[model samples]
Target: MKIKSVNLETVCGITSKMPENDKLEVAFAGRSNVGKSTLINGLMNRKSLARTSSQPGKTQTVNFYNINDLLYFVDLPGYGYAKVSQQTVEKWGKMINRYLDGSKVLRLIFLLVDIRHKPNQNDLQMYEWCTHYGFNPIIIATKADKIKRSQKAKQIKQIKETLQVVEGTPVIPYSSMTKEGREEIWEYIDMVYEG
Candidate 1:
């Protein structure tokens, strides 16, 4: 899908209400420091529109980016930051739940994880939560270039086994720096919108 126009249409904080959107919505979920913003920036073909930061837990709101006036790329707040307090984390969790339970236009979720390591407890919980809410999330393993060529398969296998993902879920190895796997992700989005 060619992005002709991009607009940051909506931003929902922890206490704010999610907008009642009519277009198809796809969300990106992952832990802090997982390159969620970087992936979004790469996907949108823009630099820093999603606000990549040097610090973890930078994104604290549900940001909705209107794409070509057809779909919304919903950037959910990143979770699992150790330096953050438990109460703040819980609030973010509630914000995510509110979005999942209330978004009528939500069609898919792209769950991002670091490709160099195993899935953590928060990652597992997030995966289960997405499935429980009827979304078979597409796993996007970020930082693919950080690992060696031979290690990729083993790391991917570890992620799958650790998460216990559902059968046939796509686990895409993505590199924001190299823009690898970006086309496949866009193709999947096109498929969802076309069908």
Candidate 2:
């Protein structure tokens, strides 16, 4: 995954049509405030291109980043924000589902969870929904830098148990600030496409 070029090539709103892309697609799915934009920026080796925000629910649309013209990094709308209205949340859910159902080039989905706490109900539901859509989402535990080194194993175990992920599924702990676990993620991505 040598990122020779990266471009924010597509932005799909609630009613916008998903591009009929010809490259492999990988999606990132997670709750709002999960540091998704930061992770994406790190992966692209660029700062603030994905638009990190102080407010939750800031990314209200699906963003597609063309990566090296070989793959598409799909940033799905963040879910499970408390301040959003029920109607708006429902629409976001539908929009995500629609993209998952419609994309023909989609190869994998990475579901991010905050590492400081056990998986919540929304996280569980999202995990289940990803499975229901025929995806074995690779879980990325975000905010790894916020926790103590001694707590890392325990928290990762708790997250896996709470999500009830199948045996052998990946659960990676990632830190945007330290850029830890970035190479492991890139290796996994490259393997999935190259192998």
Candidate 3:
């Protein structure tokens, strides 16, 4: 799908604040600093479209971006930030859960993971949650450029093992810095939109 136009429509703190339109929505969810924003910007072929940040847990709200007036790219707040209090994390969890369970138009979920590290407990939990809720999750392993080409397979295997992803589900290795896996990611998006 060609991205003719992309614009931030709204920053929603709760599900009620989400855009009123019933466009197809694909959400991005992952741990803090997993390069969710960067991947979005890369996929749109625009710089700073999703507001990349150096600090983890900077995105504190569910941001909806209107794409070509046909679909919505929901940028969810990252989880597993240690600096924040337990209460704040619990509150964010509630908000995210509400949006995930309540959104009728949410078709696909892209779960981002830092390729340099193994999938943590938070990542596994999120994957399980998606499965339990009946959402199709496409695992995106970001920062692939940081690793050597020969080691890519090993890393992918480790990630799959750690995350316990089942067969047939895609686990794409991506690099926002190099724009790697951009086409593959878009292809996944196209398949979702077409389906």
Candidate 4:
């Protein structure tokens, strides 16, 4: 799980075709402004390789990061941004769906949700879509550092129950600020990729 080399390998827009990559691919999906970029930056041990902005929906394209040429960390475009029009959202949806249906080496999908709030309609729908795609997504509750230590279990339980995840799904609480749960996430990834 040591990151020896990382590159912003490819950027696929709505019309762009997904790379026919030979390496295993892991993807991240979440609502707009849910710290996906921050998580990616934390995982890569980089400051801003995956652009992080205060604004939501900044990532409009599917970004593929090459991790030591071992695998591709695919960042799907963020969903559920209110500022954009419905047509734009639909385009993003179709683009995401295309990647999900088309990628051959896609191994796992990590669905991110905010730890402080109940998953909204978009979150529920995304979870359902991931399941429908035949992926048992590992949920990552982001911004864990914002919550109190005592509230961790309750929040995690709420996430699991709200998503109604299948048994044995791992929901790791992550914080970009404290970098807590980063190692656990990497360990889980290693187990899945190397076990």
Candidate 5:
């Protein structure tokens, strides 16, 4: 999974249609401020290709990043932002649902959660939605560098329990700053692609 080239191929807004991509698609879903953009940038090995911002809920569209022209890293809009209006949130939700229902190449979803906190209601809902769509999402515990190494296992356990993930499901603790767990993630992606 060595990334030789990365392109922001498509940006699907609330009223826009998703591209009928010919390549495999893996999506990233999580709550606002959960470091979705950071993780995407880290995974892509780029600084600002995914557009990280100081404000939460800045990602308002489904960004399709073409990875080495082989697969797509689908960046779904972050959910559960309080500052956003209810209508806007609903629109975002509908847009995500449309993609989930409409995408034919979507293979896996990497659900992100903050390592420093328990999975919230929104997080649980997102996990449920992924499962409901018949996708067994791989949990990525972001901000792992913010916690102590000793606390990593405990936090991962908490996330699994809170999300009620199926047994043996991987909950990887990842750090965008240190790039911890990046290789594991790419390995899993390769496994998914191969399997």
Candidate 6:
């Protein structure tokens, strides 16, 4: 899973706008400001390949990044941003749902969450949606570097319990700052590609 070339293919506001390529797609889905873009940039070993913004709700579209022309890393719009209007939220919902449902090349989804807090209602709902729609979601607890080593296990446990993730699905602790869990994440992605 060595990434040789990473290119931004398109920024899709709706499913119809998604790239028509048939390459395997692994999407990153999570709430706003959960460090989705940061994770992607870290995973690719590119500092600014995916834009990182201090402000939440900056990613309002499905951003497609082509990796070595072998796979597509889809950055989905973050949900549950308070500043966004209801109409905009609904539009986003439809766009995400359509992309998830219609994409045949979608291999797996990385559901990112902030490691510091409890899983909120939106997080629970998104997890449920992934399960309901038959997408294999690997729960990623991002920003792991913010927490102490002693608290890591407890935080992971709380996230598992709160999210009610079952035995098969994994909840991996990850950090963009330290590149922690980066290899493991890629291993999982590799497995998905193999499958």
How much is the lDDT of residue 60 in candidate 6? 73
Best by the lDDT measure: 1
Which one wins on TM-score? Answer: 1
Candidates in order have lDDT scores of: 0.91, 0.88, 0.84, 0.89, 0.89, 0.85
Off by over 4 Å in 5: none
- Give the alpha carbon lDDT tens digit for every residue of 150-169 in model 1: 99889989999999999888
lDDT of 6 at 123: 90
20-43, model 6: which lDDT tens digit per residue?
768898999999889988899988
Model 6 earns a TM-score of: 0.93
lDDT of 3 by residue, 1-195 (tens): 778999899888744465665788889999888888889888887888787767777557888998998888998889898898877787777777778777888888999998889988878888887887887689999999999999988988898899888787788999977878889888877876788
Tens digits of per-residue lDDT, candidate 4, 61-173, equal: 99999998888899988888888888888888889889988988888999999999898888888888888889999999999999999999999999999999999999999
**Which stretch of 10 consecutive residues in model 6 shows the poorest summed lDDT?**
13-22
Q: Write out the backbone clash pairs for model 1.
A: none
Clash totals for all models, in order?
A: 0, 0, 0, 0, 0, 0
- Cα RMSDs, all models: 1.0, 1.1, 1.5, 1.2, 1.2, 1.6
lDDT of 2 by residue, 1-195 (tens): 678999999999988999999998999988888889889999999988887757778567999999998899999888788888988888888898898888898888899999998888888988888888888899999999999999999998998899999888888999988888899899878976784
Q: Given candidate 6, what's the lDDT at residue 38?
A: 85
- lDDT, ranked from best to worst: 1, 4, 5, 2, 6, 3
Runs in model 4 deviating more than 4 A are none
TM-score attained by model 5: 0.95
Off by over 4 Å in 2: none
Roughly what TM-score does model 4 have, to 2 decimal places? 0.96
Model 4: which ten-residue window has the lowest total lDDT? 51-60
* Predicted structure 5: clash tally: 0
